[model samples]
Target: MSKIIDTAHVFFFVVGLEVRQEFAHGALRDTSRARLAVIAGVASVALPALVYVLVVGAAGAEGIEGWGAVVGTDTAFMLGALAIVGPRLSGQLRVFLLTLTVVDDFLAVSIIGIFYSEEIRIVPLLVALACLLALWLLGRSRQWSAAPYVLIVLGLWLATLSSGVHASLAGMIAGLLIPAYPTRRHKVVAARQLFRDFWQSPSASSARAVGRGLSRGVSVNERLHEYLRLPTALLAVPIFALANAGVDLRGGLLVDSLGSPVTWGVVAGLVLGKLLGIGLATLLAVRLGAGRLPEGVGMGSVFGGAALSGIGFTVSLLIIGLAFGTTSDLGRQATLGVFVAMVLACVLGWAIFKVAARRWGEETADLPMTLEPPVDPEVDHIRGPEDAQLTLVEFVDFECPFCAHATGSWEDLHERFGDDLRYVVRHLPHHPHGPIAARAAEAAANQGMFWPWLDFVFTRQHALERDNLVDYAVELGLDVETFTEDLDSAEVAKRVERDAASAADSGAHATPTFFVEGCRLLGSYDARTLTAMLESSRRGTRTQEIPA
Candidate 1:
């Protein structure tokens, strides 16, 4: 039982949460993409289940109870193959397909929890629930350390394993409980001020401190996920595959198993079911007004992508373990069915994509030189004279790499412009830590020391832990207790949220976006290029010097 539980636990801990986080992230939104993601997940599951039933009944495999084996899309194989075609695909199309896979993962895992588990022990089950409650409180408290959370989850995993519930469910539950918002969020003035301070001082300790502050800006769940991605791919997946993928194809057993009903059922369900399920559901979603096709993507492209979705590899092997006895000949043939179906699916998908691309290829246009984003100095954190003719507003996430590039020149812009430029900082925390940086800045603003805090954040953009934030506050001579309290205040959170809403209004979807005199700017700009841009904006002349 211990060995059995450990295998699935490791798989879910690594592979499961990786997919779950993406679904949870998209599902949190109510927009069309989110709705489409949800509908796609349901459709992926339902259509495959329907197909499995028909194939099983027709093949006389109804007694086998291996129906769940055909219901999941192989996330890794499908995505890897699709990436080769991504150059010809729109960014939106790639996003939807990835999201669709995430939804399918949730469906597959849910089936394991519901249908594959054995008899349960009530006491250990209660213990697992208690562990979950403790984990929730840890996230709510914003502890920001991984050690305690890891310990708690291990306990949860153990309890879950002993309770007869699959231990993989523990990892999924822990992932869902990670706090979505930062303690306070962004600190524009504090970040800028810290950057200036660091430039003036240039000490190793402050650089290290600032690095941590920047890292702290990322939320616990997102940070954990990113850190785990490499290990999950390198260690967990390969090991799981090695253990479960070893099927004895040596005997006349291969010929005999191929003749079995389960083999035919699995092969048919994965190849045929995925194509019809994903393609038809997307069409239905668009027709019902629940979703829209990705821009420049037509029905041909949709069908092609749907065909690609049929390439189920890693995930299919996992279902084989859960739904069938691995030692049995039936399981061996089912595994063979998966491998064969995947090859056929890949070939079919590629052929469809070639025809679709040739027929419906849309010409890509050059990006615009600049766009117009909302520029309200009244709502932004302004540094420099508010009446200055050149007001540059930056929509930033402290955790974003491009924002770090832009942070260096912001303080110097003031020196160059003197009283002629009004620099406004708007919070758009697309990064998980964005909210933390925002809140830290707002809390400092309440203390009349926003610039110093903002400078600290920018200087240490790589290090934004709770302890680090507190240390920075103490270093800046603010009341540490008050600053900490304000970091968690509802008012501080609302202030940052207000900036996010404004960002949406202004069409600033991506981070490090800027607006000069209501005209938007992208990418990192040096001192010389910025001077040219300001002059162009001031003169009301559109220059092609900057690419869109």
Candidate 2:
């Protein structure tokens, strides 16, 4: 039963790890802040372990080796609590916390393997090392098939178990080595062609070809994460918790735990240590110019998140099992401490968030909802009359394929509402060539040919080099000398930067984000959906004019 429970824990931990990696990859835009998040995560682990050791050593307790219990945050429980007690729009704060917990979990697992594992066997250890090498090679080769990787990982787990190192370490290592990347435009186009072929000829072979094309378009890491996240979170984690969380409280055990130094050490390490460690490290990082806090996420939100990081239940329980036998007296004491700390952490987090909201006046924890610096006909590039009743604003990145796909939707809407709708374009570059492409457009706008340049560039996304941009200017009949000069001018660069700043303020993280009638659109930017939304907005405006 114990072996089965351990295997279940390892499996679910790996699944959670992959999901967390996806979040970290998407959220970490600023490299400096990413480094600060890592520093703060290290502090969260080191400080708690130090505090636990000091408290236990002071009390002369025999279970001082159990300091690893306070070194990790329960990703599941912490996220669940955050949803209940955290600020309403906590996108940036959630990013910061997710990045920090990734580091926290890595350190906790390393501690378990190093400090708690039994005597290691040399032959099995060598076998595990070879398996890890094969996994790395498979990732390097970009193998889309999941079967080869799965077989190697299973063998790695068995070898690690036989070597007497904690088997969960294999899961962590395998997950990190798995490559993750955004789907390329060419691959997506290929998949679409394959689907069309299948549609034209209905047969098992054609259907299988379509499936293979679609699977190859996405990275194996993402495929596995999507397949495994729900089952692991809802089923495996709960079962593992049930198997390990049984503690008898009859007789004097409960009373004895109240006086046990090991109990207080865990409570203090988690509740006090995490708050002070993460909070102080964040402040120091900012002061030292490591990075500023994420936009819309103030210091108050940081402290509130720090308080919630104290609910170290899942990994804490696992470490407790490894440090002391599950049925031992010391294990029960530590378990009691974990339960007490969870309650205290949640209450503390709630109080901090409430105070931050009232005292700091920072009610919104995400980017601003409405567009910043409302549109100006005199300054902005407009496609229709300035006095039009309806407005559609799009933040665009020329290098993005999805933005290219959205041009058709814009044209369809233009035909439907001509003269009654005005369209505005803003820069929100997300690719490496995005800034230069935006600058090129701005330079063309100086020549009174911005719209024509936009139409031409979207059709030639494959060739956006510097020379190609100059050729495009000549093709568009602009003064080649003036266009070249303006492309490199500081003013043109600033123009793109201003639009990007507005995008940040307006909460546009991805290209092709649309705003209609001053409200950000939430989902489905297809032509039909956008038209319905526009019609609804027009109706609402007319209704307001009818006096109550």
Candidate 3:
């Protein structure tokens, strides 16, 4: 009974990342890719489960049907496998596997809530729904206190527990309700204004106001995700694993299970089922024009990725607990089978990945995972000390929301590192408004006001029209006539062309591709990483570089 409570705590923390940054990942956007994910994810579960069914039916197994255990793909174990494989794996393989796993985890949680319930309690379920509604309302409110929400979550958790719905489902439910929009423009501007006030006053009262203002800039979802992340990953997950993963394998149970249908089902299903299901689904998707393989993810890489997807532990354990009595002879045999299958899956997947990756001409180990023509100091725009030890480069597109977000990281870097870091910005000009904004910045650069113009663009990216760009020039005290002329000047156009060409060549196809110490930083990063990267550069640390 307490196991459900603790597992919910751990699993919710794992899945709640969706409300903050998880939705922002590239694979989540396309309807085609999302459909592909659903297919692959469902197949990954269903195929394994089919083997369980077939073996149980054929052997006339009694008192247990533990198909649910084989359906889970353990995210933690899969990530551990990736770490063991080193960072030389292609980006496409990582993204596809991650998407598949996340989708399947959600699906499994939904199944648990729907299929694994005890006697239903209508009143408690309604009460839980009401509490969730309150959570939703509070999440949308401009003014909020963590205490109220915490109390409500307690209410919701208790109600969910009483209602016979899996308590862990509450986490996923709450996550689905949390708003995922970016930090809004007006809110950011207001935070800056509040900071401006506090900066001038330098008092405890004003500092409180500034802090509240700054807090308002982040979504409730993002803050909660960060706050709950540490204990969830380090404490809750390990505790749940410790409580469940122990198996008494000192006798004939192991040998008996080797002939048991349950044992063979788990081993064969997770290994062979996942490989064929994920690979064939992907191949079928491409043939049906549903989705294409991500770049650098060949057929062989898909084979490797699917093999890695067989690592199922946490959720599988949860399903086993739900399926049968732990002390029953059948359940004990099932547990032994699970342990044996887990080991086999890991070893088999690793072996398949090595062979498949080798066949694809991918380096198996120790390759410098970085793009060629490494980031150099020679760029279009430069700020900070010319002799700084590290060069921080960004491929900027003013119209891109991510580039606007990148400004926060850049400002934090400049303020903290000062003379130790040289900040370089170059244009990608990929969007409709990008060329105009780039030209405007260049014109401002002629007046030694480039940074100011860029700061304006970062804050007001949606307003980067021709008239607005000109208005920004006036605000910055630049000569309107000269600025207007420079927007179309041959030299400015050539500069934009040169930077665009250089950025394209450097694998900066995406906006805000950052290079720290000549090594590209992929995915999302925060201010702390920026500081650490600068420190690492100063210390001449050999940073891990993967092919971009």
Candidate 4:
């Protein structure tokens, strides 16, 4: 039963990891905040260990072995609790906590591998290393098929198990090696071409070909994550809980655990230690110019989140089993401590958020919802009639494949609404050449050719380097010398910056985010869905104007 639980936990953990997306969206996007998060995460773990050592004076190996139980934050439970009881708008705060927890999980797993593994077996270790190399080679080959990767990862897990290293480590290592990349425009185009062929022929062979093309367009990491996320969350985790969480408290064990130093040490380490460690670290980091809080997430909100971070349920339980045998008295005591800490953490977090809301008025936890610096015809790049009743504003990046694909959606809306709709595009430079491409568009706007420049660049998203921009200028019939000079001009740069600043202020983080009549559109932005939403909004406007 234990071995089965361990295997399932490892498999789900690997499937749940979205390494590239997590770093790109959470940490790398905000370096200073990520640094602060790392510091806070370290402090959150380190301070608890220190607390345990202090509480359990003359720390014996047995007493110290339990330190790993305090190192991880249960990401699923913590996030769910926040959604239910946290501030109403918690998007940015959620991102911040997620970044911190990623570092927390990494450290916990590393500690398990370093401190808890049994005697090393060299032969099996070599086999594990070879399996890892094979997985790496498969990733580098850019193969979309999932079977080879799955088989290699299974071999890796088996080898690691035989090597006396925790097989869970194999899952983490294999997940990290899997290649992840942005959806390429060329691949998307190729997939669409395949679909067109299927549409014309309509046979099983053609249908299978379309399926293969569609799968090939997406990376294996993304495909696996998408398909595995639900099962990992709803099925595997619950099974793990059932197998590991049953504790027999009938033999005076509950009463004995209440007085145990190990029990109190685990509780104190999580509840009090996480609060002070994370809260103080964040304050010190900001004071030392390390990083500011996510916009609208005040210091008080950080404290609340810090309190919630103490709910280290899953990983803590896993570590407890690793540190002490399942039948040990100390294991039961540690489990009791975890339950206590969870309850205490929840109460503390709720109290903090309630106090912060009433006392500090720091209620909001996400970026602002309304459009900042509302669209102005004189300054914004507007299409269709300036006085059109319906307005669609898009924050776009030229180098973003999604934004390029959204060109069809934009055109569809334009064709449908024609004179009744106005479309505005704003710069949100998220890719490598995003800023430069935006600047080129602005320079074209200087010569009254913004729309044409936009059309040309969106179609050529695969190439947006400096040379490409220059070529686009020549193709658009602009004076090459003037266009080139304007491309680097401070005025053009400022124009793009203005749009970017507006995007940030309006809570647009990703490319191709849209707003309809000043309200940020949520969910899918396909043409059909957007059309329905627009019509609904238009009717609502008419109803309001009828003088209710």
State the lDDT of candidate 2 residue by residue for 276-306, as single tens digits.
8899999999989987777788888888889
**What ranking of all candidate models by TM-score puts the best one first?**
2, 4, 3, 1
Error of 4 at 430 (Å): 4.6
Off by over 4 Å in 3: 24-27, 86-99, 113-118, 140-148, 196-204, 292-302, 361-390, 399-423, 429-432, 439-463, 467-513, 522-539, 542-548
Top candidate by lDDT: 2
Off by over 4 Å in 2: 1-25, 119-125, 157-164, 244-246, 291-295, 364-369, 384-391, 405-407, 412-422, 430-432, 465-467, 479-491, 516-548
Could you tell me the lDDT of residue 175 within candidate 4? 77
What local lDDT score does residue 351 receive in model 4, on the 0 to 100 scale? 92
lDDT of 4 by residue, 1-548 (tens): 45543554355345335644555343345777768878888888888777776665554425667888887777766776787678887877777786677677767777877887567899999999999899889988888988898788778777877787655556666776777776676788888999999999999999998998898888888787777776665765566556666677879999988888888888888888888888999999999998877776888989999999989877788788878965789888988888889889989999999999999997877777779989999999998999998988999999887772345898788778898898899999988999999999999999999998888788888898899899988888999999999999999999999999999899888877888888777656778877877887778841111100
lDDT of 3 by residue, 376-461 (tens): 44544678877787787777899876663445777787788888788888888977999999988898888888887887768887
Candidate 1's residue-wise lDDT over 67-134, tens digit each? Answer: 77777775555655665553243444555665676567667767866787556789998999999999
Error of 1 at 212 (Å): 5.7
Give the TM-score of each candidate.
Answer: 0.63, 0.86, 0.78, 0.84
Question: How far is 442's C-alpha from truth in model 3 (Å)?
Answer: 7.3
Error of 3 at 109 (Å): 3.9
| Model 3: lDDT to the true structure | 0.71
Residue range with the least summed lDDT across 10 consecutive positions in model 3: 363-372
lDDT against the true structure, per candidate, is 0.68, 0.81, 0.71, 0.79
| lDDT of candidate 1 at residue 110, scale 0 to 100 | 70
